[model samples]
Target chain A: MLTLAGVGKRYRRRSVLAALDLALARGEIVGLLGPNGSGKTTTLRIAAGYAWPDSGEVRLAGEVFDPDQATLRARIGYLPERVPLYDPFTVGEYLDFVAAARGLHGPSRASAVARVIAAFELDAVRTRVIGRLSKGFRQRIGLAQALVGEPDVLLLDEPTNGLDPFQILEARRMIRAAARGRGVIFSTHILQEVAALCTRVVYLHEGRLVELAVDGRDAGLEVRLARASLDAVRARVHALDPAIELRSAEALGEDRHRLVFDLGRAGVARAELVRLLAEFADLESVGEATPDIEQALNAALAAQARGAAA
Target chain B: MRGFVTLFARELRHYFVTPIACVVIAVFWAASGFFFSFNALFVAAPDMVSAFHNMSLLLMLMMPLVTMRTLAEERSGDTLELLLTLPVGEAAIVAAKYLALLVILVLMLAGSTLAVIPLALYGTPDYGPILGGYLGVFLLGAAFAAVGLAASSCAANQVVAAVLTWALLLLMWFVDYAAALDGAGGAVRWLQHVSFSVQYLDLIRGVLTRGAVVWFGSVIAVGMVVATQVLRARRA
Candidate 1:
């Protein structure tokens, strides 16, 4: 639903984003994964029409987006990283103001405010001043205001940054629910969040965009076994499929070791390897592996470093 | 237009909800009351010429207080991002804030009219000059409000905004005196042409010249445009 074509941004003599291109489609939750100063926030700000890119254009639904056209730009909702809010305003009042600012009026405005309050579970503190609320509540209100206008596109910067684990889960659910008919582009440093919540993910490094290619056929598995039997387990896995490669092996305290395997290049099913290892070692646990976000990130950065060196 | 109306209303509501507006309004009323009562009871003046003069000066000093937080607070509190991304243009945002400050000025000016009641009761005050004086002060307040908003847009904090506004208004107010110096020449005459005191005194003396009207109009326009441009430059 939104696209940034050859977008570039520079501050003084330094470039923050260079010839970056991205497209977000309806119902797609694209997680912008990058470390600090990776231009993720800059990309979101440009897409939200809050800032002008030094080069290229931003298009919404096939039309070049114009920041001056209030009515047309209201179709996209944005939540900055700081969660811009008026401390003096109550939760309901703030939502009402945002709803009206988006051009909704009278009954529609009231309904929009009420709908988001209910959706984000803000009814409890509806009348409390935002400044007096806790960080978690304030974050929820920020998310609520962005969704109050029911815009077609949502741009959120670290939407779950300050929330606790449960609150983060709630925020993730709220974001997923809000994405039914809208496109979402959210930035964050948490890899697990991207893995759990995103339909697609892209990493940004040194002002360049890199999309993580995940083939449906290739998978990863984690096996926990007695430490002494790790070598036996490895030998058996290679015997089954010589193409299988051990990504990493870590000791689990005194007796057990946890081994991660890249099942991508192997024809052997993970179940067969687990059963064969169980006969020789005391198998503690076996399950699909969570994508090692840190490992992947380090590899990507290292590859970029080598390319620069070459 | 919808965004402008909503923001305008929200700003107006905030002025009442916060303590700063109440304090400013209270201080204005108390000081203006003192000026009027001192003029009537102590100075034994039957006319409102001096009262309007004092009121005009009071507005010049208080307008910065009224407008200091309009844009400066948004910038400091980080709400300007939310505002900029909302489909509202920079011009509309500035206009809405300016209009809200104008409404406060209108209320204060309207309340000051109550002081004229004693003049109508005991003294045979000429209604024409009194009416002209009210118009004069309103225009002066309008010009002050605009300058204050411009200062708020440029400054990093409210105190700096207020100080910048005070410096600018005082310069405009004193330019007339500077033009009367012994060595003053053609350039000084040009400076006097833009002197706020000179234009404002004309309206107080019941001389509604086109030059004076245009002077205030230009000041208001320049202030609004400067404030709008500051917002635009930040986005760029």
Candidate 2:
């Protein structure tokens, strides 16, 4: 697990991260969602101990991160946004060097190199120099290097950048596999990646933690009873819970109606509503609605804008 | 320490895999050999010591070109981030790079030993002065490599690294020249004391002065320390 408290970084006069606080649990894939220059890379760099923050502390697995501490460094695997790699070295050679640098020696180092090569499906290009490989292969090699030591934490910056659709899916599968036992924190501008790959999402804007949301917790469905018309169903739902705001209502067919409700923190249970509706007419089937991450992200941004104006 | 050796091996491998190291050693060998042969055969010199002296100047110029890519190329290629993020310390990274350049210097200096073969075949070659001259050349190359590495650390581009290293070496070469000028004694004395060629010249003449040895060693140490600081500060 990783925790950041009161973390702030300033370059010259510009503040990159402003008192941002976040905690990622073990086996949880937390996606850092933000636009460009939202301090995503800076946060990851600070967490990886590659860059010293101006203020605040980072704790990984109960130990405070010290820039001079090599033991803590060995517990972290970081894939920078640029994926710095030596072009002339073969894929196996690069991984071997990284493994050695991480202090794995002899047979253990060789075994780690072989394991990551197989895990990333890089056996075909094991002997090929990284410079000759395609962009997708190079990215895979980068990921392979990061995973070589089997660190306790993985910090990846835009791991899916510059990949094709198939490669992206493959990378997602690999990331999910890596997150099975370790704490994984990845940053990206893509919203859908959070829904597909991350269990928790942290939104950053202008160097601050804007919002944190559980991926599937904020969605609910509204069902219209067959005994009532669309308007009647809306009115009945409104009567049951005065706080339920009707978003839209329409008649599907004879005696069947569809109604959408925006529950604003009134905490109305679907079963209770269905049971209450059964008194007036026969209750229809109920299903939960899924809210898009993009919509939630936009709403968060809009709320931040309004708060800034206020 | 193991990390340092691994990094050193990787850097050395990089040098060998690319043509940069080969081209530098080959060109230096060809030029030094030609000059030594011409002075010995055509001019009928009694010894190869003078040839050794002239070869030192060539090393002052060529060592920078060989070492300019050590850190500068890593910066330009964006590989420094990868290196710094590893569990290795800053001193290990600096020492590894320094050792890699030292290996190349040893190979090139060893190549110049072939010039001694002809001298022993025909003329009476003094093994003492030859040994002393080699020690001096090795120290001079080490110092040059350190200075070049420092320049490379400060430079963002390879061309600028090479040029800045050349300028630094040239200044050291002319330190003695400026020391003889009027009213420039203070600045000149400091420069002369740190001059790579001046310290090296004493060793070439078969004189193993402690002051000269310490001077060259200090140059290497100070240069490496500054380079390490630069890397650390940049990461910070």
Candidate 3:
């Protein structure tokens, strides 16, 4: 539903987005993971038509976005990094105003406002002015404004920035629910949120697209074993087959070690590695390493840095 | 048109909910009324013409306070993003704010009309000049509001908006004063004729010429157009 081709943005003398390419299909919830000053917000702003890219183009549903063409704005909903709200307006009134601004009129406007209020679960403080609401409520109201128009594409910058645990879960559920028929591109630094809410992850480092990975179930488990030594166990495993390359062997405690190996390339199987280790030392446990999104992100960033240095 | 109406209503409702609009009107009306009563009742003047002149000055000060928050507050609060992202033209947003300020000016003019009641009751006042005076006040208020809105568009905060607007209004008023000085003739005189307050004074003396109306209308039109351009360029 959204396409960005060779997009770039520069501020002052520094580049924020560098020839970035991104695509979002319908009903896909893509999380943009990046640290500060990584151009995540800049990319989202360019997509929302709030900030124009220095080069290249952004297409929404096959239509090129000319900043002069105001009609295209209706097809996209954006929640800025800092939720800008009129504090004097009540939650209901704010939604009503947003509905009307989106060109919904009469009964349709009323119903749109009502639907968003209910969908975001804002009934409790609907009558209260937004300035008086808690941060969680304010964040919900910001998201509520974006959802008021039911746009085809939603660009949210740090949607769960300042929420409590419960609020974060509620926001995750709401975002997942909205992704049923719409394309969502949410930028966040929270790796856990990406694992929990996003179908795919887009990693950004220093204004460049690093990697895009599909989020999947944890296929590996992690176990800390107490044994004679990781080197002693690894030697026994290597004795089974000289082709096995030990990834890492680190001492945990007194005579305890954490061992990691590349099981895929090894000629021997997991059963063989376990049997050889058991023969050498007392086996504490045998398991797989769990998938870690943070580890993946760090690796991607580290590789990008290395590439830049090279 | 729907978007414009919606934004305009929301701005008007915002004023009613907050104390900014009310405080401006109250302070303006009270201050102007006191000056008028002191000049007319205490000084034993039988006419309210001078009182209208003083009220015009009051508008030069108060109109900025009324319009300072129109766009500057939105920009600072970050709500301008929400407004700009809506499927509405920039002209619609500018026109809506201009209309909202005009409505507030009308209501303020209505409140200031109370000063005319005593003149009508106790003294034999000419209704023609009184009517002309109110019309002049409305036009001057509109022009001031427009200038204030333009300043608000450029400023990032309400305080800066108010200060910039007041400076622009003061320049207009000072232009009229400087035009009347000796030795600066011809072109300067013509420039002074374009002074917003000077043209407004011409209408206050029961002289409602089409030229004066056109001048004020043109000022408002240009101010709003510039404001719209600023908004569009920033987003771009």
Candidate 4:
């Protein structure tokens, strides 16, 4: 529903974002992963129409987005990294203000505010001043305000920044639910969060975007063998399919080794591999393995470092 | 526009809820009351000319407090991002905020009207000059408020906003003396013409000159436009 085409931004002598391209479609939750000073917030701000990109254009539904166009802005909701909120306002009052600001009127405004309050389970603190609430409640309130207007696109920066474990799970559930009929682009430092919440993941390094995965699909299996050597297990796994990729093999001491293989890419059936390993070594526990986004990102960073060194 | 109305109402409600607004209003009433009593009882003045003049000076001092947080606080707290990203134009935001401050000024003016009750009861007072005096003070307050809001948009904090407002208003106030200096030239005449004190004196004296009216309106317009420009420039 939103696209940034060849966008470039510079702060005086420093380039923040350079020729970056990204697109978000409805029902897709895109997680923006990057280290500090990687232009994640800058990209969101540009998409939300709060800042102008020095070059190229942003399009919403194929129409060029203009920051000065209020109508266009109404179709997007943004939660900044700092979670902008008025401390003096109660939860209901703040939601009401956001609803009205988005052009919801009278009954509709009241209903929108009520809807988000119910959705986010903010009814208990509806009358409580936001400043007086706990950080978790305040973060929920921030999320609540962003969804009040039912904007087609939701841009959230560190949406689960300060929440506790349970709250984080709750927020993830709510965000996943909210993305059912809308597009969401959220940036975070939490790798597990991206793995848990995102349908698509992208890495940003040195002012450029890197596509990491398409749908965070289960692409492999992680198996722990009780009486197998790392080299022997690797040799046997390779024998199953010469093209099979053994992503990782670790010696766990006492003749035990853990192996992770990209079974999907290698076209090797999980049962065939298990049967073959069972004949040579004692059977051990095995489970589906989601691609380790952290490992992939570390490899990408290492590759970049090597390129720079060369 | 819906954005303007929503923002204006929120700002008006905000003024009523904030302790700083209440304190500023209270202080203004106390100062205006003291001056009114001094003029009516001690000096035995039959009109509200001096009282209105003192209230105008008091407004020049107090308006900064009323407007300091209008834009500065939002910038400092990062709520400006939320506001700008919403479907609201900068001009509408500035106008709504200025109007909200104007409403507070009206409330203060309404409270000061109580002084007229005692004046009418004790002595014969000219209602024409009293009415004109009210108009004059309202215009002065509106101009001061607009100027204060413009200062708020430029400053980084409330304290700096207030100081910048005082500096700007004092310059306008003291420019009259500069024009009155001997051997002054055409530039001084222009300064005298633009001087806030010169524009406000005629209206308080029961003469609402078109020049004074236009001058105040121009100041208000310029202030609002400048504030809007500052907001736009910050987004860049």
User: RMSDs, each prediction?
Assistant: 4.9, 4.1, 4.8, 4.6
lDDT of each: 0.84, 0.83, 0.81, 0.85
lDDT of 1 by residue, A88-155 (tens): 99998999999988888999999999999999899999999999999889988888888877899999
CAPRI level of candidate 1: medium
Better of 2 and 3 by lDDT: 2
Candidate 2 per-residue lDDT, tens place, A1-310, comes to: 7889999999999999999899888898889999898899999999988898888888988889876776688888999998888999998899999999999998999999999999999999999999999988888888888888899889999999989999999999999988888889999988878889988888989888865544547665656555655566566767877656544322244434555443433357666766665666654666664446665575566567656988
Show where candidate 4 strays beyond 4 Å: A214-290, B180-184
* Model 3: colliding residue pairs: A221-A288
| Cα lDDT of model 3 by residue, B127-152, tens digit | 88889878877888899999999999
Q: Score the docking of each candidate (DockQ).
A: 0.66, 0.69, 0.64, 0.65
Error of 2 at B126 (Å): 1.4
- For model 3, what is the error of residue A47's alpha carbon versus the real structure, in angstroms, after optimal superposition? 1.3
For each predicted model, how many residue pairs clash, with residues at least 3 apart or on different chains? 0, 0, 1, 0
TM-score each candidate.
Answer: 0.88, 0.89, 0.86, 0.88
Using lDDT as the yardstick, the better of models 2 and 4 is: 4
> In candidate 4, what are the lDDT values of residues A92-173, reduced to their tens digit?
8989999999999989889999889999899999999888999888888888888887999999999999789998998899
Q: Write the per-residue lDDT of candidate 1 for residues B1-236, one digit (tens) a residue.
A: 54788889999999987887778777887888888897778887656777778888899889999999999999999999999988788888999999998888888877778887987888787888888888888888999999999999998799999999999999998887877787887769788888888778777655667888888989999999999999988887
lDDT of 1: 0.84
Given candidate 3, what's the lDDT at residue B161? 97
Show where candidate 3 strays beyond 4 Å. A214-291, B122-124, B176-186
Give candidate 2 misplaced runs (Cα > 4 Å): A220-289, B44-46, B185-188
